[model samples]
Target: MTEKEWNGDFDPMADPEEQKTLLSVLDSLRSYRRLAHFNSTHVRRQAFYSLPSQHWTLLSQPPFSVLDSLSKLDDLIDSNAELAEAIFLEGFKAFMAPSLDSEWVASIVPEKYAHDEYQIYSIVMDHLNVQTTQGDMDKARSCVNQFYREWSAEGNMERGKCYEPIINALYTEFTARSQDILDLDKSDLKVLVPGAGLGRLVFDVCRAGYTVEGNEFSYHEIMASSLVLNHTDKAGQFNIAPFALGCSNHLSRADQFRTYSIPDVHPRSLLESEGTEEKVPPYERMSMATGDFCVIYSQPSYKGAFDVVATVFFIDTAPNIIRYVEAVRNCLKPNGLWINLGPLLWHHASRIQCSGDENEENNDDLKYHGHIDAGVGDPGSVELTDEEVVALVKHFGFEIERHEPGSVETGYISNRKSMLQNTYRASFWIARKK
Candidate 1:
């Protein structure tokens, strides 16, 4: 029989090389915290803070303190790296205890993401085992953050299926407003969905018997959308583990972590009618374009081609949203309607530093990732208020036909008990091109 080694081999007073590793891990975690600020995590944190205690109490175990851990780790890394590592390992073990439901996760996750799905589960289990010897809550948080960055599209697609309230709201609004104006029998109305992330909303629009074109900016989202659209049927479901690995204090309910199903969008699903045996025209009018929204519409053929321009959770993505308004105006024919539903959260309009000058909108070769050239003499730095945005739309020849100010319970890649939630008030409008 192999002799058992001493349970405590190292001297309590003597610090070792593990401290170096701990310092490295802490530094990486600090970088992640910085990155989290830039990503949608800031908004997600706001949503977490707004949750009621009852909801959190139902989903979490005691000693759930991500921010506290961060603060403590910061102090330790700055003073005594060895001590920080020890405490971090303890917290990591607590995070990875046997309570997680791995079997359930494997079962619901889409077969297409089998590798990432397995990798997600494997990483947690492997790290938990490592925590028995060495690990950190910060490290776990980093893992979760990485997972989210890679799998966010899948998670968002899941939420899009659950986006019934928004879908119903739009369906009702479109039918009531456009029924008299649009002749579906004579011609399929040309519809354009800008910033169509995963094409779920586009599918919804197509179901209403309109020819739809979805525009997406991100290459990753475009690929994810293609995977989902090609592999899944109209009503297929998949699963995603959105927040199982994060150890952030905002993650108030870690124990409630589990996989969630991505629901499917059926043809004419919003119509709310029973199925019929009679043959119907199949939904083939839907297609997606990968390019900058402002750049694509500037082309002569695309200008004044679409009958309806619908943007949901999209317009605010531009650095200068006025450019978005201009692009929409350029694309819609006279009397065409521009339907929009989203919060006025200008993603790129944050008062961050800009090259060239704030007043210069068309600084040629002034290329940021999604920089919108709002044309010459455009101010590109400042973010406009919701009222200001509407005014700009009106200035661009769009007359506000209907404007409804209300909130919607919406989120992307949110967990049942995680810290991040995307719920916010959305300004809905039906602006007709005059």
Candidate 2:
């Protein structure tokens, strides 16, 4: 494809529908551009440049066409920018891919997605000879770090967009179905939201009139969530730029960045009541904790401490799913309600070594620090289906009170452009300890 055709086809300005998704994809791929620039300049510099003297030649090349083979991708992009979404989608899938095992690339592709992606990105960079400006690199680094912090279930357009949807689901279960499912009312409830990313659900649960404590293992998430929980007073406004760019088919929103806001979680008691004199802040009893879920639950103080365990977007995070079942079984008081949500997407089930047990001996502690890793005994572990999970919980002395399996629309980063809605089936259930 000619440069003009490529430019026109990939431009995000012309199409309004395509602008949002494209810009979001571009925002996600910013770190990659920076990484490619870094790789070109520092590691394997010779591979990216024809010769040191030819650096000027590389600099003179068009930004998008820096690589000769780029035309092939450009042609594909020109043919259909929507189809070209995969170019950035697959390339950075690991960074922003949905955590659902059913939607996992390994289920579709025979090989590990990350392994293949690393090579594909490397080759693309070699062809592009991209040079990342120091300022741009710094911004890229910041963006990358933020994405890493919000990796699992934050920053993504759907997650941000679906925040209300998720809350709606929980609200339904907590209120409409409370008596039928958990055999309890929602008032004065003590909730423990394990694997609470960004503490959204935790705060929401509190707003729903429950005393909540969110337990998280990731330091980045804990810090990010704490900033909102502690720093921001009730009803206060706070903004965080989780992504750097929002490039689209046209460059219209290509440079458009997104800022995810901390939702206003007012203390329930703060609302003015008719003939009421006293008002209490809603989050007065809410708190956040940082520690391994299994370890924390296994602790003497935590065992049988919580009245409810809302493992939303969690449970599948364990290398051994049985451990989570056991942890929930241990921590929850007798007949305590366990409202489990989200798909049975095993975090360890992915083709990549994203997360694992850190308790393993001689396992590279550093490797599992930022990203989840399948510890020494991990890697190649099989994920259990929802049915299996239900049976396992039953074996662990819990009776399933409710089971509703359904699909939900979700996507990483933003989807302002494409009307494409990525959906995954999730197992929603409430199990009670016998």
Candidate 3:
């Protein structure tokens, strides 16, 4: 066949080779633009909006279009940004309709998860609205209390059993990496696990002879972690040591978790009781360190206190990524370490599928109840990405030590038919304050 004849019938759009070449060129250009834009604060903010718009335009266009568009944009921006922006833009357009700032009630929950989400979203929205309008701090506090009480009443009974394997995998990866760099024998070495869900990592660190504390914003998470650390065989099976629980008198120096109540305060009656004076032993057994931890407060500020801070699967949980990193950076001491793990850009969507059995119908209600208890509505609530996370952290004066894309997998398994096996590939970063 003649070269011209062969070329005559060729369609560039249909050719994978041609498409790949064009994509590479576009990607190279985008990368250069991103670096240039990021270096300038003004340009970066503009880039954020423009890039998302461009993605929407491209994604809104043909066959394999959504996936293709994502692939193209993913090459240009960070994954977290891509995922978050996509979810926000799509969900906002559908739900918000007129104003970006307007509140949106979900129209339909994924068929499988609808009832569960409906109840949770209803309570949470009511709580949010009430909190927004009430000038009375006391009233607001009461509202918050009521919200949690209602949530917990449902959550305790129907919440799916914690997936032990995923937790173990996460712990294994975290400890292995941490031990490589951290000198545990350096007495008075302190670590902070901000948003230390369920105390898995904190428990492990204490076991490793490092005095560690967890800082969690949610009272539910704190209580859950306390139970897991204090009551479970997992702690004994792992032979993890406990940190010395300090009393109110030890106020001069106290680790984050040990020093404060999980909710930071209890009901006045609970506070006024005789039992309130009883000191619970610190969750772990460890020597009294003379100094405080280099605190890591994920998505919030503990400001200028920690020697080391670590947030695993944390940045994405922030409603505002930039604000979250600033808070985390503010908590770290000068030259302190910051470690992060988990997917940079991702969103969880609920979808219903038929289980093909009448017995399985009740499982749907249980799942729905769990969602209500956990308060899982709205797309923008928790959205962030690796690039944005890095950028935000750097904005707070952290120098990147290492960044690995797709570094870890959370192996989650469940015998419960209702539980979905979701695999997460996460980015890992270790940064130090400049």
Candidate 4:
């Protein structure tokens, strides 16, 4: 459907905070549509040298065959561009539909969320083209990478390393806590996954006979996940080249250009063995929620609401680690389990920067301050050592039933064929509310 002109409208939402968040997500998804351009620009710049540096002798060198190699490279880049476009386009179509902007945003606000004066901004895809930034491109790239990491068959190796222990540990906790579903329509067993990137882990947990909610903060991720979790019709229904935009440390060019058929298994077929397709037979077990992990789960409504709180590759995102611990403790039932698997790669500890209108912005406001690298003062992150985090967990009324430090080694969205690989020796832990 054709988009109505933006009119630069500043429509008001009942809740200003939620309105701001929705706009932020919309902005992120809109920028995603420009992914092909961002990557092509980078690939071309990396593959070519300055014209001034190339003299006739060098250009015409017989052994090198510069033109021949470049000709082939150009062909590959073309393929890469096509693949990148397809990946972003397919992932974004559902969310970016013009109808979604008005309907979804307008419906944002339930009762009890209100603002006397709310001002929210909206950006159409055409306007996003004008406002695209390197940051937006970086986020777009992450969305593509998440497709493989969360849904593709090739990503199973890494997912196994990071996700298996949580599943197994939860199994022990679920059996210990609740013997039967409270309601046939609704399972008494409830699991909450924080930092639930792309909803894959939530899907897995839901398949284990527990109702699970995947909560995420990144709009790019929310859009990407919602696309597949809801829209995909069959196994391997979506295809993407996650590594196509990469320009460094490749063992072979083929590695970077490889295509992946996403979601090796159909989400609907979660429990084939039981004859029921979904873990919750009617597909009611799996759910997705979008917002800050600390803010959403810390609410009164969520207190003691979950049988298990699972964090996977997520704790390091906290500005203050204590807030994370508090929120987890707050939401779990007495003797509820908190299972975690991740490296403490403190996401907020990046070098700080204050630029332009952002000079007054708080460092914890990751939308602007995240990867920028200038400025002085504190980076505004409370980064804890592995030991510190473990002790912190214990301090917050959790008994260390299990703790395996640096045990699971895995990569996030890694190219298996890349010569240089960055893998994390993630710690795995399961603690009970004491």
Give the number of the best model, judged by TM-score.
4
lDDT of each residue in 74-156, candidate 1, tens digit only = 33223222222222333222222244576765665557766653234434433432221123334433343222322334455
For 1-434, candidate 4 gives per-residue lDDT tens digits of 00210111122233544344444444544444344544554445455554556653476466645555444444554543333344344433433443346555445543343331111122233333343345555665677667788888888998988888888887766565444544332256688888777788887876666787777666566556665665567888756667655557876656766778777887655444442644355255567665556666777988998888999988887767888898899899998889998998886775455665764344334642122222112245678899999999999899999898988889888887888889899998889898
Candidate 3: minimum summed lDDT over ten consecutive residues — where? 238-247
Compared to the true structure, candidate 2 yields what TM-score? 0.53
User: lDDT order of candidates, best first?
Assistant: 4, 1, 2, 3
Clashes of each: 1, 27, 13, 1
For model 4, the run of ten residues with the poorest summed lDDT: 1-10
TM-score of 4: 0.75
Question: Candidate 2 lDDT (Cα, whole model)?
Answer: 0.50
The digit string of per-residue lDDT tens for model 3 on 48-77 reads: 446667775664466325444333333333
Q: Which candidate ranks first by lDDT, i.e. highest?
A: 4
User: RMSD for each model, in Å, please?
Assistant: 17.1, 17.8, 26.6, 8.9
Give the poorly placed runs of model 3, Cα more than 4 Å off.
1-184, 232-302, 345-382, 412-421
How many Å off is the CA of 28 in candidate 2? Answer: 17
Error of 3 at 375 (Å): 16
TM-scores, one per candidate: 0.54, 0.53, 0.37, 0.75
TM-score of 3: 0.37
Comparing 3 and 4 on TM-score, the stronger one: 4
